[model samples]
Target chain A: MTEAQTYSFFLGCVMPNRFPNLEASIRKVLPKLGVQLEDLEGASCCPAPGVIRSFDEPTWLALASRNLALAEMSGHDLITGCNGCYGTFKDALAVIHEHPDRLKEVKKVFKGMGLKFDGKVEAKHVIEVISELGPDYIRERVTRPIKGIKVGVHYGCHLLKPSKNRPWEQTQKHTFLDELVEATGAESAKYKDKNLCCGAGGGVRGSQVTVSVDIAKEKLDNLIEAGVDCIVDVCSFCHLQYEESQEQLNKELGEKKYQIPVLYYTQLLGLAMGLDPTELGLDKHVVNTQPLLDKIQD
Target chain B: MTDSISRETIDSKDIDPEFVDEIVKAGADRIRTCIQCGTCSSVCPSGRRTAFRTRELMRKALLGLKDEVLSSHDLWLCATCYTCLERCPRQIKVTDAIIIMRNMAVDHGFMLPEHRKASQKLLSTGHAVPIDDANREMRKDLGLEELPPTTHSNRKALDQVQEIMKRTGFKDLIEGEKMEGN
Candidate 1:
């Protein structure tokens, strides 16, 4: 057995505030897999990479670097449940590390508070951690293997795009996330526009709700066409987009209502581990989980 | 409403040649490397519905059509999904270049109201979308602490975040104020 390494968990804003079910499920599942989730207390937002980074570069880099610097202080690498946070750390670190001038600026921002980024800590997405545990290892621990359910995998943009910065998914051919999704005995369904945005990213949802939800509707229609029971997502923001779009699409497209539930990756993993659906916060989903729950083999 | 052609002659005098240079300065130096390839436009999630043509926007930047690029609502139309970034054969940072243009837009007071609101929430609460009462209940229902022990729950830590933003002059930048040198 490989010794599990401890990681300081960087809980990005949306997970804690909007999707606590994700926070709980991750907290519950990873420990059983021999990974310790240390609380990176006092960490601020990954500041949402796209929203701030698009609006201001130096501020985004400095703030993200501050979060990374805190992770470095823990003497362990960092892990996050949100792809947005993952990208913020990954892209911010890559930018600052590659450009000494930017790094110096970031250091100058940190100096007043006595924090420094030795550039030692690396960011890992929750899926990356699951991948690190290996599918075979994960498969062995699945007591109540999910069966007969087709899942559309939402690989949120920051999860894999900008391949240079992200350690996982270096190429479009990378099956890391798909492999992890399949380990729990569910079929990772092949869906349309597999790599499209969930419409909640890049501040689109924040700035233009109708347009954002419309894009999600397009993705959802594709998912429904592909005939998936539910969506398995790694990023909470993307999770929110899919979950909300179910209702939004239902309203907009009259007489062709689509109702699909969504699960953050850990929530699904927790259920496969035989944790009570309630314990995994399954019932907390905006869209009812009963449809998917009914499909679960007793 | 008339279906008529309205034409205006454009010359080098009507363009800001430094526009592309500004975008380049913002970590998107690959702007110069774009080959007018329409690959970005084809892959754009935003262009499917909105008038945000990725290739045309890049071309506008390439040609230094500063006013056309900056003072248009179309600037915020991109979702920044990076699909265009991924599919661009030129490997142009298509999305990043747009972001750079948006930054330039903000400096020129062409910022989107909604983005400004999100940035404000981030500035004040250290979150783009702060915890609401509904989600507070949701967090409690999930058996986790209502506040995730972040800057939101700790005022002192939030002060540090604000200080970092202040030092970087990010607050002023987002709020549409002049930085010290300006």
Candidate 2:
């Protein structure tokens, strides 16, 4: 029989609550592309940059390995929406794949949880899979083309950093997101500081708010400086930091020189795929996407 | 009590005690293994931007310069992108060190009030910060809808967070906040 067309979806922390719209959009859009997101019961945070940073190596190894093992058990490839989840799983797999000794240690940690990870499963960021699936196929599947919507692309830190196993390599010049957005007939905004971080990293916001804001401010200021209509990103954490920090920074800067809505690329993709604003959960983000919705609806 | 206090306290004449050692013994046990290779420093984007140095922070932590590590803004400068942890030769969890320092600072009342205010907002509202009115107007101007619904406030969600934190001993670590009262 043909292999099942389903995937074990890993919705890391923040998606269910902080950015429910992004999740909704993904769920609404993926099915149209013939991808079925299989549910895995009882999955926890990737504990990335969080537990991994704070705990012993074995603890982090076991924690991330446990997440991978969950996907492995579900008999479908592990597909995640969060950038941190993607990075943690890919990083753990790389570590275990490269070091036999480390794999043994991870296995020992898993054994304690009465689990064993043979490292056979594949971990993919949602965007990586989409990019691999080819923009042409994506374009053909689009029921709605987001014409006239000018969008700024935020590739995020984890996905862009390390750049290992990046599905496409453009040595001279490449904008993976811009290319994809254009495939939907949307205009990719030309923004300076298009690559700055959202400062959600290092668990900084959770521990040190001042630092986190300081970091996010740099990115927001840059995007505003560029004059983008809206910010679109693949990582929910980046989406959260950028969306929330833009509002906070506007207050701090004492003038509303910039106010841009944040969209998980999936939500934007959902729109391009002809999904309705309500179906994509656009009403749910604290940053508000009403303006974008109106533009699309109009 | 005076003798015990004197023994525990350092005078102006004493060398700066190894504060990093104290933290390591206090469960940040990965300090001594750091190799100070500068891999973390070079790889850090913020370090590249602001001269933030994780290697220097690790060195200070290794030397037990508690006051130096906690007071210096370097720890705050990290974005926690995990680049250092990925590239570290000795596999030092540089970002985790920063978190530990922040918690220690907050516990000691060294935290900025703004940071505390934000945390309170998160604790109460299940969000890190509030949305500004201008942002609301901007969203309307952009034709997007109002704030979306959330799955954060439910007992199941909160309980799940607590359970995970418990599993990771993260609650106990942050619970160190209470020790500040003493």
Candidate 3:
């Protein structure tokens, strides 16, 4: 399939609600780089792959198909900032392609609603789009590197899972996300369990909060032990876990606060592009960033 | 929380003859193919802290231990992080397979309450995590629109989401369960 030069932006539930700044940064950075982020207007949730899909496969397909139909109507590929939304769109796209009977079932439902999902629209993540922008394009464009800042990269599971489905780097020895982190001149700090999750997927954080916080607490401990200044992630769900769970982690552990700030890759990229950190929404972060920002070479 | 629970000692009556096929029909087509390598279990992030052994779960699914697999709280312990799926040597699609089991569990009227609340929120608001006032101020701070062009801002689109939910019985399936909250 020939990749389209322009794509519709698929903003899932979290970005619009919990982290609008991340959305603002993506909008500010990508257009300047020549990637058009068309609004996927009237789009609903990706219906949350882990939660909704777990209960009923056909229901999940119908919901996902509705969003894909919206994107297919727009004549551009869908580019999502969230991994769960990406996984849902790509997984639904894959199932329909692999199973005609399923597609027929989903289409019959769409027919009742006067919409169509032709499976022509490809669901691309913003990270993959940046990588496709090529390393040199990013390197040459860097106007101000927040040089010497160590970034702990969190590649959320949904972004690169079921290896058969996603378009990101190969699971083994993956550096696709890392390479993008370095494009800003901030080193991708080596942390144990870097490939592990932020412990907030599959509705676990909502249902099993203790278990979810336990897993993230370990990952953060590992991150801090690695001496990284901040966390950089491509998916907002992981950002939510890493950013929101720290307060809970400190409460549960009865320990000193884990105050590491979480930044989406686009915010880091915006800083490298010489965009004001306030315009990138850095000041609105849940965790403190003053010490981390102080260390940046500016 | 996990220390008190012990692995079930399987007996002949524990096996439901059709349970394996039922799982396959649910989309985990390769459950019987697991070689018990313990690779999936070792790499599972949830497995390390919780009793959710991916290898053991597959063994139960293959052995047709329906009562043991569905009735245990350990069933819901997987974070669906796909770490096991990434690490699975057999390429079992472990996370998806676990979700298939969860669908079966939901059918049997077994589900965590927190998940049910989220499902209810999705049905009602069209967004699973609906917008709150704090986020509204944050959006204003970023000089963007208060609400995204989503169901939260559009009623007709939300009705479309509910229509899909109703047509698919997702509303009933999620709301039908009366499990006590975890």
Best by lDDT: 3
The best-first sequence of candidates by lDDT reads 3, 1, 2
Provide the lDDT at A243 for model 2: 75
Cα-based lDDT at residue A75, candidate 3: 84
Q: Each candidate: RMSD to true structure?
A: 4.7, 8.4, 5.0
- Two-way lDDT contest, 2 vs 3, winner: 3
Model 2 bad stretches (over 4 Å): A1-5, A50-52, A110-114, A165-174, A253-255, B1-51, B54-73, B82-182
DockQ of each: 0.63, 0.12, 0.65
Please name the candidate that would achieve the greatest DockQ relative to the true structure.
Answer: 3
Model 2: number of clashes? 23
Using lDDT as the measure, name the better of candidate 1 and candidate 3. 3
Candidate 2 retains true contacts at a fraction of 0.12
Question: What share of the reference contacts survives in each candidate?
Answer: 0.72, 0.12, 0.79
Q: How large an RMSD does model 3 have?
A: 5.0
lDDT of 2 by residue, B45-146 (tens): 677557677788887666666776666666666776656765677756565567677666544545544444443343333333334455445434434333
In terms of docking quality, model 3 is medium
Ten-residue region with minimum lDDT total, candidate 1 chain B: B173-182
